[model samples]
Target: MTTTPEGTPTTARHRAPGAEDALPVPAAAGSVAEWTERYAHAVMDTFGPPQRVLVRGEGVYVWDADGTRYLDLLGGIAVNSLGHAHPTLTAAVSAQLGTLGHVSNFFASPAQIALAERLVALADAPEGSRVFLANSGTEANEAALKLTRRHSGGARPRVLALEGAFHGRSLGALSLTHKAAYREPFEPLPGGVEFLPFGDTDALRAAFAEGGDLVAALFVEPIQGEAGVRSLPPGYLALARELTTAHGALLVLDEVQTGMGRTGRWFAHQHPHLGGGVRPDVVTVAKGLGGGFPVGGLIAYGPDVAALLGRGQHGTTFGGNPVASAAALATVGVVERDGLLAHVTALGERLRERLRSTGNPLVREVRGEGLLIAVELTVPVAARVAADALAAGIIVNPCTPTTLRLAPPYVLTDEQAQPFVDLVAALRADLAAEETP
Candidate 1:
């Protein structure tokens, strides 16, 4: 361990390796093919086959077992805020663990307290807003679900969520999540959850008007991540706020994929079109919050809403662990120090514009804001496009059969991002040819 000029302890071992770490060729057992084969037997088949077996990374590029480097546009599904092996994130986690790592919920650490304060400040939350830390986006939504029910003060309280929302996979969160394939097998989930058409002002008004009295809360994603980066229609969030408030139902914004500067703002709900005229009663965040360190949080605004959960009502064993808190704090600090929000805003526009400019026949449309983007293909060949991009040393996500999503690291430069656009444009014919009749 060594100290940098600013006195933060730096673990030199965590730094990206030099030529010494590279192998002439991947070891037989360590190769992607070999590891992938073994993974089938050892690991569950939840996320399907592994895409690639990555060995090491630096900045926005990661090297695979075969020493092939790739520009990671997905950023671990929008979780890597500072990109791979960020010095600040590594230093903060290493320093905090060296000082004080894990502590039970019975105790409190400075890192935990500081992170809570930082999140509250970033949200520009109400004066008495409170924070509840969890380990993942699903866990955060689980906490929020419980809080809403606890405050419902009735035997049965109905909760509403958007049709295209992806809250999490846990049973509680799954109940709020709206996907037939992901939800059908997990039937008999927590009850009283209903789905409403996303971004439909008329439907929102109708739902509330019909059953406002039975509703306890409404959960929505400012920008639908899993649904191919579908953003709420203009003025829709404001409408949601108006209806939820009028019906006395709490409005919850799920920022798991859009928060932490992924959308050029601290929270996507904070965008001018959404945050200016409306205020969410609760906000659930994770993903980039810890910059790949694994942390989630729920911010409840207003005194009444904050007071809903009493001490024994809800808790987590490892929720505000010191190491995770330190990582999140460092991630946010670096985002501000580097002015990444503005960078994302500018770079996002350039990337979107370039993708649209290609004017390729296979391209349908480009959507989303900031670094979170989605390119809809005229044919249902997005999966093929992603596979092609991967073979070409670029990593993008096929969020749907026809939608290719891009949530690159904020640290991704103009040079790095431009190649992705070019690669995708070149892959148009290859992608179209892969389409099944």
Candidate 2:
């Protein structure tokens, strides 16, 4: 059984007494079976069946209900940058909560202001950059979308979004997301949005060139995180910047999944491949920003655009709560103080090389920047491979049927990378043998 900070035995809400103490128990339908039963009774089925009852986590590892430990490579979808329960983050949150947990927008907290200032500085845009804090990635996009409209004078409300983009599931942000399945269910989304093929500069230029003043903004992900970690070709961001500027449309970069040192840079759009010279008018960030705490923000550069949204434009009660801001401050401090960007760059290169050198026939390609990587297999069995990896005491994810994505914690150790590669190689061989009949 795991113990909390107070040393009290922590039991799963549904697990019976002594069930939490079971360690290294045989892998059976019974272990996860009990969890599935308890989970169904306790929680909403939003995420479907509980894959595993995660009981405890430390650093880059987590233990299941049966006390089997697995190396966590997904890092809670790239949110746990300092890894699970890092003392730095926990202390920051604890101290801030004790001081002041939350305050209304009528008042401002130092932590909130400090975090905003830090983000503006890190973004390195021109002077007078303003930040609007929010509670999630989708909210960040919503804020940005609203800001764009405010700049558009309401006459031009249309937005140009990239195909295969996954902004968020929220109704407003859903309008900008291109996936039909995610959008169809919530039909009649805030209208006046067009989708363009990702990385196609000509398509973007043509759209804006012909649309003239109708498009309010060009919403793009520097690196499409949900579309199997796809990255843009060199100079695509620069082209977008030029075209958006020429057409009087704001360029809003959605760095929700690729920001906060995930791509070895503070933002993936800052990569040299995107010319590294272009500046976005608005940038939305989340995911790794708060290091697991829920925090998001939309940063608008220059006063003309930054001041578009006045006092009554948009607001949220939990948006800039002190606890979340403090967590974000601590996360940003640790990343900068520890030089984690450099660490991520080096470690990510090593991971990519190791995966590429495995000589596994199933692997068609391995590509990514920094820790956000995807291993694409020739076959569409990534879901099975992810399951197999979990069963083998490692945790990974398949963003698509043939693409295995890895976004391990920035604190992942060199020693931990090889075991995962070896495990995947074994999985590849087993799958190949099964197919060879």
How many residue pairs clash per model?
0, 0
TM-scores, each model vs. reference: 0.93, 0.91
- Residue range with the least summed lDDT across 10 consecutive positions in model 2: 7-16
| lDDT scores of the candidates, listed in order | 0.86, 0.85
Off by over 4 Å in 2: 1-32, 429-437
Q: What is candidate 1's lDDT per residue for 359-383, written digit by digit as tens?
A: 8888889989899999998888888
Tell me model 1's lDDT, rounded to 2 decimals. Answer: 0.86
lDDT by residue for model 2 (143-240), tens: 98888888888889788999989888889899999889889988989988889998888897789777667989989998887889999889888888
lDDT at 228 for candidate 2? 92
